[model samples]
Target: MPSALLIIDMQVGLFHGPDKPHDGERVLGNIRRLIQQARERNVPIHAVRHTGPDGSPIAAGSPFWQLLPELELDGDIDILFNKTRPNAFHGTSLAQHLRSGGVDELLIVGMKTQYCIDSTCRAAADLGLKPLLVADAHTCMDTPVLAASAIIEHHNATLNGAFARIINTADIQF
Candidate 1:
């Protein structure tokens, strides 16, 4: 089955200004590597952007809506889906896009561990798409009760082999 990399919610809204979360810069290198590898192998790459109502952080035209510059995307992106909800599937064409592309497996990487990232993974499973999350590729801001690292570790451990498999970027041999 053909696989696609679902690069979700890497927009400027999540990374620019204020204190950023969980070393987004650090994990970006890994995301770039994955993009490069996928390109070389002719694998499709789809980008998901999140938008919200006025005054929302991810409102349209905000700097945060743009993807980070480090993980460069070319004009040849397989698909670009705009989502208003946490789950990428909610009112979006993501499922149809994947199905039309003949994509059976998905490599997920993005932001906000407890929100978009987590929700999308579960939704993909519900849609019968095999979702593989890059363990170290997604991160979140530090919370008062838990550090960012701990949150990431917990999500990986809790979600591994269930919500999704936790694989390092290096383990993606495809």
Candidate 2:
């Protein structure tokens, strides 16, 4: 089955601060590579942008809610979806879009390892779609309780091969 690359929440607000949870630059580089590969292979790429309720940092119409520049999305190569909740599947046409495009496997990547990344993966699995999370392609900032590295390691260890398979960029064929 053909796969669609789901690049979630690489928005401006997430990468704006000096203290980025995951190494923003490194994870973004991985996303860049994946996007390029997808384009080269004629695979579909979708970017999920998060918008919170009024007054939130990621509110709609704010520059902070836009995707970061590192991904270099082209109009022909990428599609954009607006998501109000953490799980992009909730009340969104993402599933329908994938199904219509004959995408059975989803390549997941983006911010907040413990939140959006985790939620979206589980939701996709529940919907019977194969989800492959690039282990090094997603990242979060360090929290007070655990370091950023620890968080990424924990999610990859616990989530990989259970809910989703955590593969690195090289593991991907396209």
Candidate 3:
């Protein structure tokens, strides 16, 4: 019943600049909080970065593709990998890493609730790795159809029970 923390795309490009992700400050704080708690408990932490095509904000080899400095990930992550798709497990070694590490439960938190968060939670479920999504730790900007908060709420409601067990940062234990 060992658990690991999966931090996806908490990169500088997404968090930096004037145009911020929805609830950026609080989300960042929550992520940082999780990392610290995980470290204290000696829980293995894995982080994934998304690499987009050239000229995109998160293009490979770009500064934006780098992890945020505030994360202090020097030893925060036990495994670090990259992905080109929304799902972190797609075309990546993430699943294998988790399997080999004996990680049965994954506490997921990161950017773009509708994209990476949703995709990874489902993939994790399909893989038989228990995915516990931190409800308030994942975030995204507002879309044309809905507000960011609404999107987070929607995903929380939808992903609960079936795809992942939705937990808040305060309630999470590694």
Local accuracy of candidate 3 as per-residue lDDT tens digits, 8-119: 9999888785557999889989999999999999988888898999999889879989988888887434677889999999999888888888999999999989999999
Local distance difference test, candidate 2:
0.88
Cα displacement (angstroms), candidate 2, residue 22, comes to 2.1
Candidate 1 lDDT over 95-132, as tens digits, reads 99889889989999988888888899999988998989
Q: How many backbone clashes does candidate 1 have?
A: 2
Task: TM-score for candidate 2, please give it.
Answer: 0.95
**CA shift at 161, candidate 2, in angstroms?**
1.9
Clashes of 2: 5
Residue 128: error of model 1 in Å? 0.9
Candidate 1 local lDDT, residue 104: 85
**Model 3 lDDT vs. the true structure?**
0.91
How well does candidate 1 match the true structure in TM-score terms? 0.93
**Model-by-model lDDT, in order?**
0.84, 0.88, 0.91
lDDT of 2 by residue, 1-174 (tens): 899999999999887756765677788888999998998899999998889888888888788888887788765657887898889899899999999999989999998898899999999998999999999999988888999889889988888876888889988996
Sort by lDDT, top down from the best: 3, 2, 1
> Model 1 segments beyond 4 Å from truth?
none
The top-ranked prediction according to lDDT is 3
